[model samples]
Target: MALLALVLLAQVPPAQADPPISQPAGPHAVGLRVIQPAAPREAGLPAQVLIWYPADTSVSDAPPLRYGDLMATRLSALRTDLSATQLREGRAQQQASLMRRLGVSGQAVLDAPLQARSQAVPAPGRFPLVVYAAGVGGPADENADLFEYLASHGYVVVSSVGMGADGREVEETLAHVEPQVATLQALIRQAPQWTAADPQRVAVMGWSWGGMSNLFAAARDPQIGAIISLDGTREPALTRQIDVQRLTAPWLYVSRSPDTIAQIQRSGIDTTFSLLNAAQYAEVTQLIVYPMQHADFVSRRMREASDAGYGEYSRAEVRQAFGMVALYVRHFLDAHLRQQASSLEFLARKPVANGAVPHSLRIDIRPPAKP
Candidate 1:
């Protein structure tokens, strides 16, 4: 039966995958570049930082960014135990799956010239800076789509490789948190030097473990004007330790569907305590996306996963939800960092009012506690 299943899987023809994520609604063209910061060798920071910012050049003829290459390299490192024949077969299968899932092309053009550098000389104004923190031990570009979208919409997005204190697999402890926080602070400090980033309007966005790290960064650095978390900061063990008084930035927490009582009990998660609840000092907006699991928060994972990966939700539905996530992040940044009345009003409305599918999301907004 196993052999027959394998044969059937191989014979299945690839269907047309979903289209690339929609072009952002921003007026500016997008550009991507990598910067290598000069830090003392013993400081233990990432060697390269990826920056996506509004560009002046046309991307019409530029080659689409190839995310598959990065995925393939990561996969190869993890599959060293496979025999040569098995490895080849696995690669072939992966290629086929990718064709059927989403094509490997990402939205950004590689090393595209900065908006200021291009010949099309636009107005001279600094854009808000957003420092992205990837999941623990994840690559810097794990949320490439979100970064690209934000860049197009007039923000300078910066990120570095997510690593632990020992520079290996990140464990869930304060030790692991220290390095990630340091990296985010370093990126914030370097954003202005590398690009036209507004130091006063900085935001930190994180996924999973990086999400928790951003909270720590905000607690220590008041300059982080806003916070965005993707299905992050649910760990009771970790959230209990955050100094919520210092975490006064307006926060947007996008979470997955709530766990059932039985599931919560089974996992030993304390349902009574929550970081969001504890954060009475900041204006908080909680968006619960029903179609997404924890892994689905990362656009790259959503694009790469198989049909089973989405579970009950169709690929189209999940894709739409992912797009909605991007939109919410943009609006949140705009509302807080840019102080745009339109975006602030957009966020003030319910998801349905903002054009989200009915019943797809549950949103709760909490105004900051009166001091």
Candidate 2:
């Protein structure tokens, strides 16, 4: 049966393959702390918030983060065995035995962080908060690398696990939005204890469906200072329900496919740019990565590439693409959340930072006339 499964896996789509991904080194050493905060909206389901932050010491020699069991549990529940073994075996620094024989392990660390210790004294001042939501059928740590990098760079990154349809069930995706928002609100309420979290400056980011949720949350809640999307768009009905023009937060969207961007445009999100208010579209930046599948936004350990759109690139290429994507994410947060003018200036000048990347990527800033 295992042999037959492997054969069937080989026939699976290229987009579905699990490629190895490195944490993409960041400035500060990273640390993690997990909290289960129950939101009032979905009191039955307590949300699990994975908090990643800059460590007081270097994490180079710290024990690697492990998530093989997490991936296996999520996958087995979905009836997908495509790369469960690979995830299970590569729990540490090395690949699983089966993947090693196939020569397909692409150098990914399943876990990130040296220790689960909290940084005492809170790294000088309260850090801006980043509430991250995962894609449909994804866990909070689906984009572990991105969260770790943000945390390492003096940000309090919080992601919810039970707030999304994280087990490959699309039908439940939309229904989880309100609960996800409630979860984030509850986490914010508890931020005073986190010490590192700055309740005043909060940014919400997400991948795929999570992206749409954050967008909705931003529309409803004015407290969110910024918004970031990893290839997510409005669900049509969402546009009709909420008035996006009321959303004044600076927005950054990094998408892999043009279709998704067009979908956002068709949903009338693009029209908000032309409003008379000068600040309406000043900070809205849309980035489209070429030759990058939706899976690239995800960590290699748990990516479901088969169902992703076409054009398969090697592991190295995917890493380079995502690194660039991460850079944009970092700089955007710096500009909006941290209120750094230099970061915004740098982004305007160097929109697409392609350092020998195989494909040509494009970054579009709204209005085209903003400084």
C-alpha lDDT of all candidate models, in order = 0.75, 0.61
Question: 213-312, model 1: which lDDT tens digit per residue?
Answer: 9999999999999999998857788888889988899999999888898998898887777889899999999999998888888866754556666687
Task: List candidate 1 stretches off by more than 4 Å.
Answer: 1-20, 40-44, 57-64, 69-124
Question: Candidate 2's residue-wise lDDT over 266-346, tens digit each?
Answer: 866544432223335336788888757666677643342322233466655666677778778888999988879988886
Q: Which stretches of candidate 2 lie over 4 Å from their true place?
A: 1-24, 38-47, 58-122, 162-174, 260-282, 301-312, 352-359, 367-371
Candidate 2 global lDDT: 0.61
Between which residue pairs do clashes occur in model 1?
none
Error of 2 at 70 (Å): 7.0
- TM-scores of all candidate predictions against the true structure: 0.81, 0.70
**Candidate whose lDDT is highest:** 1
